[model samples]
Target: MPRLSLIASCLLGLLLAAAPASAREVSVPPWGSGESRGEDLSIWLVTFSPGDDVPSWWGHGSLVVEDRRLQQSRLYNYGMFSFSDAMLARFAMGRLEFWVGHSSVGSTFRFYREEDRDVRIQELNLTPEQRVTVAKRLADNVLPENREYLYHHYNDNCVTRLRDMIDVATGGQLREFDRAPGRMTLREHTRRYTAVNAPMSVLLDFMMNDEIDHPITKWEEAFLPDELESQVAALQVKGADGQLQSLAAKSWNFYESPTRKRPPAEPPPWGPWIFALGLALGGAAVGLAAWERQRGSRVARMLLGLENAVLGLVLGLPGTALFIMWWVTDHTVTYRNENLFLANPLTLLALPFGVALMWGSQKARARLFKVWVALVGLGVLGIVLKLLPPFDQDNWRLIALILPVSVGMAGAFGLDRVLARLRGGDRASTGRSAAATSLKAP
Candidate 1:
C-alpha cells in the first residue's frame, strides 16, 4: 500500500523539475541594455540528470544567460512550484501551476552537485542577434505576470519550455529539422526513466490510456531534457553569416555524480517474469482450493479466505483509483484506460465474502464463486476488445499478469461446476446441491 501511495504521488513526477528551497530571484538586465548585444551575451542549456527522488527521475533543465561584459550569469528555470496545500490540491486535480524563476548560476550548480546528480551544459551556436533575442525573452519570461503556466506532462513542461525557446531563437529551424520520427513513443520514453522503480513503472503504464501510444516526432520527444539535449546537439541552424552550423557550439558534462547511475536506454523486459509470477500464484490458489474441497479442513478454508482478502485489496484499491482518474480527474492521460477490465473495482466485493467463508458459511462460498467468475469474464472481454483496431492499447504485459490469475481463481472457486448446474436445470441442480452437502459434511 505504501508503494501504491508512492505511485499516486509520483504520477506527475515525470513533469517535475529540480526545485531548490534556496532559489532566489536574480536581476536581469533590460532588453535595451548594452550588455544584451549579441557578442556580449552567450546562452547555455543546463541539464540535470535523474536523481534519487521520484520527481527528479525525468531530469530537469534550465536556460543560462551569460553576460560577458557584466561578468554575470543567470539561470532561468520553468520548473519552479511550491508544495503548499493549495498547490497539492491543484496537482491532484491536474491543474498544477508551474512558473519561471531565476537564480545565480553558481547556486544552481551547487544545489544539484550536492544532490549527487550529473549536470551537463551545451552552449548554443546562436548568432549575435539571436543570442540577444533569446536572452531578452528569458528575462521577460520571469516577469511576475508572464512567469506562470499550466503544466502538461507531455505537451509542456520545464524541458519543453527551454526547447521552445531554442526553436524561437533558431527561427524555427530546430523544429523544422526535428520533424523526423522519434525512436520511441511517449509511453516508451516514460518507461525508460521510470524503469528504475519497477512497481511505479507498471502502475503508471496501467493508469495511462492509449493516447500516449501514438508515434511522435523527435520535436515532440523534446519533452524530456535528455532528448532535447541530444536533438539540439544534432541540429544545424543558420548563423549570422547565413551559413548552416551546428546548433550546439559546444557541449560538456559540468558535473558527474559518483553515487547515481544514469537511467537505462531502454525499459526492462518484465512482462514474461510478471506473467510467470501471476501463473504461480494462481496455481497455488487452485491447489489449495482442491485440497480444501477434498478434506474440508478449517486451515485450508482460512488460507483461501486470506488469499481472497489480500488479492481483493491488491487489485481493488488501484482499480478504484483508476476508475476515478478516468471519470473524475482532469488527468487526460489516465482517461479511457483499458486496464480497468483486468483490475476491476468489483473485486473489492470479495472482502466480506472471504470473511464469511473463513467463518465456514456455504452461502458465502457460492456467492464468491460467482463473483470470481464475473471477474474472469471481464478479463476475457478485455482480451477480446484488444482484437479490434480502435482499442489499440499496448496492454499485453498487463493482460499477461492479470488474465491467468482471474481465470485460475475462478476455476479454483468451482466455476465449471456452477456453470454445469445452471445449464443442467433445477433437477440436476438439486442432485448437485445434495452431492455438495454430502462432500461438505464433517
Candidate 2:
C-alpha cells in the first residue's frame, strides 16, 4: 500500500516543472465524477469498465487522477509520466484499465507510483521554465517497454482511475503513445501483457543525478515475456519503405505450464496397452526364431535375446531423441519420427534397453545392440550437458551429442569382452574334442 502522507503532496510541486507554455486544463472522465468536486485527494479516480461487458471486475480498488500541467519542455514528459501514473492508478483498481506497452522490455508507455520505489518526494516549487529544463533531462533515458510497474490501479489505492488518460482519448489506442509494444487489441490481450512507467529521472532531478533508474527492480507478471508469446504469432513487421516482411515470430512456450499440471489418469490405461504390446512383440520374436531354425541357423538363442533388445529399444528410445531435439531447438515442434516422440521418461527406458542388450545377446544381435546402445547413451549424455545451468534456451543445441558419443565408448568396451570370451571358449572346446578322439582311436 502506498501511503499518501502530506510530505508526499508537498514533494509533488517541487517534483517537476517546465518553461511555462500556456497552462491547459485537464478533463475528468464520466466515471470519475464523485459526490464532491474535492475529495481532498491530489489526484482523482476514474473507472472504465470493459466496453464489451466482458465480466471483468474493476470496482474493487481505489482510483485517483492528478492534475499535471505540461509545457513545451515537458510536452513529451507528459506523455511519459502522466500516462505512466495513470496506469498505476488503473492497476490499483484490480482490473485491466489500460495497457502501456503490453509486456515489452524497456517499453515507453508505463505507469508508476513514487511510493513503490521507496522514493521520497520533495516540494521544489520551481518556476515553470526550470521545470521544462528538468523534464527534458529525464527523457533521454526513457525506453519504450519496461517490465516495471508499481502499485497499479488495483492495489486498493488511487492508481487505476487515471492510468488510461491518453489511451481513452485516442479511442483506446495505446499504440500511439506506446509504440514500443508490437501490437494489440483490448479483446485479445491476456495477463501476460506488461507496461512500464516513465522512468523517475523524467520527473525528478535526483533520478538522473543519481542514476536511480539503472538496474530497476520489481517486474510484475503482467510485463514479463513468457517462454512463448503472442507477439510472435500476431504481429506484422514493416520494412524500410512499408513493405510487409515475414510475420514476426518468437519461440513457442513449451516449458511445462505451471498452471496446467495434473496427475496421471486413474487405472493407468497404459498398463493394459503396455502388456498387449509386449505380448505381440514376444509372438513376433518366437516366429523369428522359428524361421531362423528352419533355415538351419546356429544363432537361435542370440536372435531371441536380440529380439528382446530390439523390443526394449522400441519401447522407449525415440521419445528421448524427440524431446531432446525439441528442447535443443527452442521447443520448435516437428513431425514424429517412427511413432516416437523423445521425452525424458523415454531416455530412462533407452538406458535399460542398452543394459539388457549388453548382458543378454548371443552373437550378431550383440553387435547391433552395442551400436544402438552407444548412440542412445551418447544422446542422453548430450542432453544432460545441454541442460546444465550455464546453457539456457539459447545454447542447448551446441551440446546435444554428448550422450551419443559417451555411449558409443561404453558399447565398444562391452562388445570387446563378449567377443574375446566367446572365441576363447569355442577354441578350448574344439581342442578337448580333438584330443579325446585321438586317445580313443589309439
lDDT of 1 at 173: 91
lDDT of 1 by residue, 17-136 (tens): 645643576555644255556888889998899887778888889999898887777888898888665665576667888889888888788889989888899999988888889988
Q: Per-residue lDDT of 1-442 in model 2, one digit per residue for the tens? A: 2421221222232221111112232332221233122222122111111111111111111112222322111111221123244433332222212211111111111111111111111112222332232222222212334312332211111222122322232233233323443232211122111101111111111101111112221211112112011222233434335564422222221122233222111212223443344345535444544544456354644454455445444333334433433333221221222112112333344344444544553454445445446545555554565456532222121122223222332343344456567778999999999999999994
Candidate 1, residue 203: the lDDT equals 76
Q: Which residue pairs collide in model 1, if any?
A: none
True-vs-predicted CA distance for residue 383, candidate 2, Å? 14
Quality of model 2 by C-alpha lDDT: 0.28
lDDT of 2 at 44: 15
Model 2 alpha-carbon drift over 4 Å, by segment: 1-345, 350-402, 409-442
